[model samples]
Target: MKRRKFIGLLGGAAASWPLAARAQQTRMPAIGFLRSSSSAPSQFLATALREGLKEQGFVEGQNVQIEYRYAEDEKERLRNLATDLLARPLAVIVADTIAAIQIKAAATTVPLIFASGGDPVAAGLVTSLNRPGGNVTGVVFFATLLGAKRLELLRRAVPNAAMIGVLTSRTSPNVEAERGDIEAAALALGQQLTVVDVNGEDEFDTAFVTFIRSGARALLIGSGTLLTTNRARIIALAARHALPAVYPHREGALDGGMMSYGASVADAYRQAGIYAGRILKGEKAADLPVMRSSKFEFVLNLRTTKALGIDIPPTLLALTDEVIE
Candidate 1:
């Protein structure tokens, strides 16, 4: 009887040992990265995001894990992607302003951090900028609000342009605001503006043809993931049309667009990453105030200018933060 009792006690202890050991192994937190752009263009943004996480004492694959879901510019896939990310036991979700909407609708408990080009307050993602007051808080670049400024630069680059073609993505929620701002700006500048709506990548060539037929001397590319993802083709179209154009972000100029003026997208992503790390470290999402993107840059590509036979204005070139010869 004593021997049997000892064996039973030893077996129970052995089973409990493995359970204790498994409990001791902490599961690492995961960050779900949801975007509407492709991975190829997102390399720099991803690196910047990682750098931000490093700043918060979190390293990918070490203390934290990042699950990336790129929709490759297909807006239709965003809701499904958000649902899939929600299925995972994610510690937090970091996304673009547009994607943030979908994620917000899918998960109510999981915290959301975003890097958006639109106004979060206007989009109803947050109650206010100073106090987000919800499970979502991150950075806003306000790229759509800079339409007038970009048009001004395009006008400066092509002084004689009376009519400018504005390419906008109709599917984006921010389109109406962008159009209103751009139209007001164009009227203020005394330049005729033709707004062309592009719904997908396939409509790009047709939009360019429409712009050409409308007799536009210059073009203003709108802000959105769809436009940014297909930047190379749009820039090519602009070059083929011999149209001097201005883009929203530096990536466009770096990718061979004529000129760009907007917030640094990579920096915004880095900020989002930093916020995500903080949230994972026990900081409440509502307590963290929304951050506005302040790092705007003006980039000019002289090579594209020369190729299109458009002379860069001395004043505009002087204002350029970066000039690609």
Candidate 2:
């Protein structure tokens, strides 16, 4: 009887070992997604992020978990959201726009991946592009630097416009840099530039009125998640004021803006996601080289141009990657 009992106990222990090991192996690591904009306009970007992680063998709710937090375009709310994400069991933090700054400040031990439209190095998110040399690394869209290019595109679309109005987000970290680049470009093109700094949706109407009163003939929208979140209103205001406008993303052109030229925002998010997955897979954030967006697309809306009574030049139209009828 004693011998039989000993053999039974040994078998039970052997069976439990594999069960415990399996449980430990299957434990899901949580990834936190922190964004400065609302989730409504970011759904497509979220899907792109998921696809990137899948490429790295991290499937949400399968081998990994995701914690999502959004600031809803309220800059004041970002810190709170970041703190909330930090409180969770996060193995890596995937952030975008201004949230990168907040996350970088809060979580030093946790790896951070960001999709920043601004200059990441200038914003102090990383040490350098080639060697990030810290806990933060991801894709930089160089959206602020593209201000000059976007201005040139607008000028081409409205060559006769003597003055152009720039709608800028005061809360954006890259606002000053973008404004400076746009100003330089405008001066080089021999055009007068009027800039209006706005922080919220409530200020759009007043800013548009001011631009119109200033005799600004065309509009140039700056790059920021907040501005993109409120894109429909900006496009509508431009149409109502009879202002030809250039935007920073293809979606803006699809939403009735006159023209757009910049890096693909969705692709940037996907790269960020890929970096997050790599970090979760035991790769150090400091080891990952910072990535720049490889895809840039120019888009034009023919219907918007027709409604504004402006004829798009064949040269500009030919340069567009996509045209919305």
Q: Determine which window of 10 residues in candidate 2 has minimal summed lDDT.
A: 68-77
Q: For candidate 1, write residues 205-248 as lDDT tens digits.
A: 89988998999999999988788778888988998889889999
Best by TM-score: 1
Instruction: Quote the positional error of residue 92 for candidate 2 in Å.
Output: 0.8
Tell me the tens digit of each residue's lDDT in model 2 across 1-325: 9999999999999999999999988889999988898988888788889988998998988888988888987767888999888888789988886888988887888889988889888999998999998788889887788999998889889988888999999878999999999998878878898999998889999999999999999999998887988898899999999999999888899889998998888888888888888888899999999998877889999999998889988998889899999
Among the numbered candidates, top lDDT falls to 2
The TM-score between candidate 2 and the true structure equals 0.92
Q: What's the C-alpha lDDT at position 179 in model 1?
A: 92
**Could you tell me which 10 consecutive residues in candidate 1 have the lowest summed lDDT?**
71-80
Candidate 1 stretches with Cα past 4 Å from truth are: 1-16, 19-24
Each prediction's whole-model lDDT (CA) = 0.88, 0.89
